[model samples]
Target chain A: MLRDITLGQYYQTDSLLHRLDSRVKLTATLLFIISLFLVNNLWGYVMAAAFLAVCIRLSHVPFRYMVKGMRTILFLLLFALVFNLFLTPGTPVVRLWKLTVTKEGIRMAAQIAVRLVLLIIGSSLMTLTTTPNHLTDGLESLMKPLKKLRVPVHEVAMMMSIALRFIPILMEETDKIMKAQIARGADFESGNLIQRAKAMVPLLVPLFIAAFRRANDLALAMEARCYRGGEGRTKMKPLVYQRRDYMAYAVLLLYFAAVIVIGRILPI
Target chain B: MALKLEHVTYIYGADTQLPVRALDDICLEIPDGQFIGLIGHTGSGKSTLVQHLNGLIRPSQGRITWNGRDIWEAGFPKKELRSSVGLVFQYPEHQLFEADVFSDVCFGPNNLGLPREEVQKRARRALELVGIPEALYGQSPFELSGGQKRRAAIAGVLAMEPKILVLDEPTAGLDPKGRDEILGQIAGLKKETGISVVLVSHSMEDVANYVERIVVMSQGHILFDGEPRQVFRHKRELEEVGLAVPQVTDILHRLSAAGFAVDTDATTVPEARDTILKALGGKWDGPAAGRGAMGEKEKC
Candidate 1:
């Protein structure tokens, strides 16, 4: 039952986006999200929508998997849409008993909905195509220049990678603990909110202890292997920008430029 | 009373793209007070089948009946079934969370809404049954050693006074002394209380020594189900599925293949010892003289 909960997990498949360097995908996602806010005109939205569609297709991640992440935030999207549609002031399109649906309100709701959906899809594409280790490695390499300021970028990256690695292990532990507690007649489903929260005490306590123990063991094993703060450590497969990576960066820049230029050129 | 699985099949991720058939039309029955060993290699669906025994995971294509009543039938006494068939998970570390060992053991009986005094009484009895000394009962469960922690976890389930105790690899990752200590205590507990036990383990030797019946599984199907001696007789087929007979049984098989007049189905240590001694002239003076005693014990 716990296995059904996916944390925007990576989908295993071979495609052009999967073959590209992690840094390229990460940078492309960032640029795409930035352009979502900048693009206001109808043509600009069209360009952004087209770009995302192509990226999703190229990534080879199932559309349903990407949309699953969107399902969790559906409430937030609806809230944003309702707030924008009824609260914004402009020419009235429809008048209800207590609220006015204005033309500007309609435009605002559409714009925000498009941007939010595009943003989620774009970011999830990166995660779906890249493994957690590669994503953190790319983040570390991208932030390497900050080492001059003693930012501990490598350590932060290592911590993130370890945290991601433990997600599934901890999930399995939770499943085991939950079943064990259930067998002992612990009632989790029928209880009121307060009682349900109280019932979680058995589950949460063991989970926290298991997580801490695992982290402790991991640290000791790393130390035993002479791991000392990632200093002068050469990676077995070091990050290098291949031809596909450069092509991806160029395409991303061109798309963002088109979106910005269209927003500026189109007055309507 | 008996727990029965009739054509039970469980498919993991059934609604997802990559579905896996974890249990495929398994049919088994567990009668009262029977010490049954569920032997399977990793991912042979032993854990899934154990969950079915207590109604934790409902079968997708079949039904599980407890005492002639469908467990998944509407308004079934599921809570009662769970308490009746206690499950100790593979690792004890993930289950014990109370401040002290005594309280941890009390959790199960407490969940059953037993009276306070009765809960304490049952918890104390369980701890004693598992060989947890009273002096250590007040200590934090986390402070106990690995084997002690395991025993405390088992006591937690046992405090519920289950008719059937299903333990999944209760002795995994322990020293031999710890393994033997825990298994021996469980054997004694079964003998004293007459509680049925379904021990799920990959260790042939451990199960052979304690259980009356062994059920061998391969790829989500039962391959063999019979007495330990009867099941180990198919050692070649068992090994093909990444499971082997007890080390003693394998040694006896090799001895018999080498033309030593010995039977290959003596799975336990004592049984194999007697079998080998009787083969080699029976005149060797050590424990060979005690063959009659061992042979007499096996008569039951």
Candidate 2:
């Protein structure tokens, strides 16, 4: 059951988006999220939706698989929808006993929900197309200027990659430990809230111990490999901006400029 | 009582883009008090099959029955099934978590809701059964040696007192001496308790040494199910599936091919020794006589 989580999971496919430089994809995703917030009316949202649709199609990621990532944030989406629906102070369209559903509130809620969904889909698309190593390389390269200000950009990137690498490993480990505890007759299900929380002690303790042991082993392995710092290390696949990246940058700039113009031209 | 799997099939990542059949149409009966060894290469569904025995995973296509009762029926008491069919996973030592070895061992019986005194009694018995000294029971499990941690983990499951013990590669990642000690204790436990055991191992020698029946799995199918001697006889078939016969059995086949009048059916060392001695016809004179007998046997 723990296997259902697809967080940071990359889907392998031979597509134009998958072949794009990780930095280009990352920058485009960031710009896409910014465009979602910058838009104010239906036209801008339509443009944003069209941009995302085109990217998703080009990536060759199945629409169903891309939507699966939304399940994890369903609760957040509902929460945002409800808050915007009920709490927004606008002209009431439907008056109930104490709550008023306004037309503006409905529009606001829909826009907010769409923005949130687009935000998640945009980020998930970046992760789904790029591998963790490529993502790290992109992040480190993006943060390279920070190194001049005494920031440990390489170390942070290394830690991020390691953390990403261990997510699936730890997930499998947790599943194994949970099964082991269950085989020992530990009841994790069918218990009261406190009882269930108490039962997690058995699961958590072992998981923590295993995590620390893995960390120690990883540290030792790195040390044995003469891994000093990220100071003077060269990447096997160095990040280079290709023509496709420039083309992607041009498209993102056009989308951002159009969204800004639409937001300024359209009345709320 | 017997555990039965009827046309059982399990598919991992079913309904996903890439579904894999981990076990396919497996039908087998595990009778009470029998020692069975499950041999397969990695990813051959050996682990998936054992997990099904305890209702840890429901089969994608078939039914599993415990003593003629379907385990997946409504209100079937899955917890009881799991407790009764204990599974000690590979690298089980990573599961140890309690403050001390004794408490970790007691985790199983305690989970069964046994009285405190009874839990303590079972925990001690399990610790003793796994050869964990009483004095070390109070020590933190993390502080124990690698082999001791593994034993404590096994004891944790043993304290559950399952009727059927399923161990998946129990001796994996251990030293040769450690492996023998763990396997020896498991064999002794099965003998003493008369509980059924399903030992999943890649080592043909370990299986040949302990189990009465060996079930060979390949590509999610049961390739062979018989006594070790019978299964090892199909050495070529087993090798095709990336498995090998016991070292002693291989040696016997080599000796037979070297023109000796020795039987190649021996699966263990003692059996091979006996076969070689018997082929010599009890001749006792000196090393020269022994060589002469061997030469005569080779000619024949």
Q: How many residue pairs clash in each candidate?
A: 0, 0
In order, the B-chain TM-scores come to: 0.94, 0.93
- Candidate 2 matches the true fold with a TM-score of 0.94
**Root mean square deviation (Cα) for candidate 2:** 3.7
Q: How accurate locally is residue B154 in candidate 2, as Cα lDDT from 0 to 100?
A: 93
Q: Write the per-residue lDDT of candidate 1 for residues B1-300, one digit (tens) a residue.
A: 889999999999775567889999999999999999999999999999999999999899999999999999999998899999998989875688899999999999999999999999999999999999999989999999999999999999999999999999999999888988999999999999998999999978788889999999888999999999899889889889998787778888999999999978787767688788889986768685466665565443
Off by over 4 Å in 2: B283-300
lDDT of 2 by residue, B1-300 (tens): 789999999999775667899999999999999999999999899999989999988999999999899999999988788878999998998888889999999999988889999999999988988999999999999998989999999999988898999999999999878988998999999999899999999878777889999999999999999998889999999999999898768878888888878888887666776787777665634756656654455324
Top TM-score model: 2
lDDT of 2 by residue, A1-268 (tens): 7865565689877899999999998899888898888788888888888889999999888888877778888999999998889888989988888998888789989999999988988899899899999999999999999999999999999999999999989999999999888888888887799999999998999899889989999999999999998889998889998998899899889988988898658876
Docking class of 1: medium
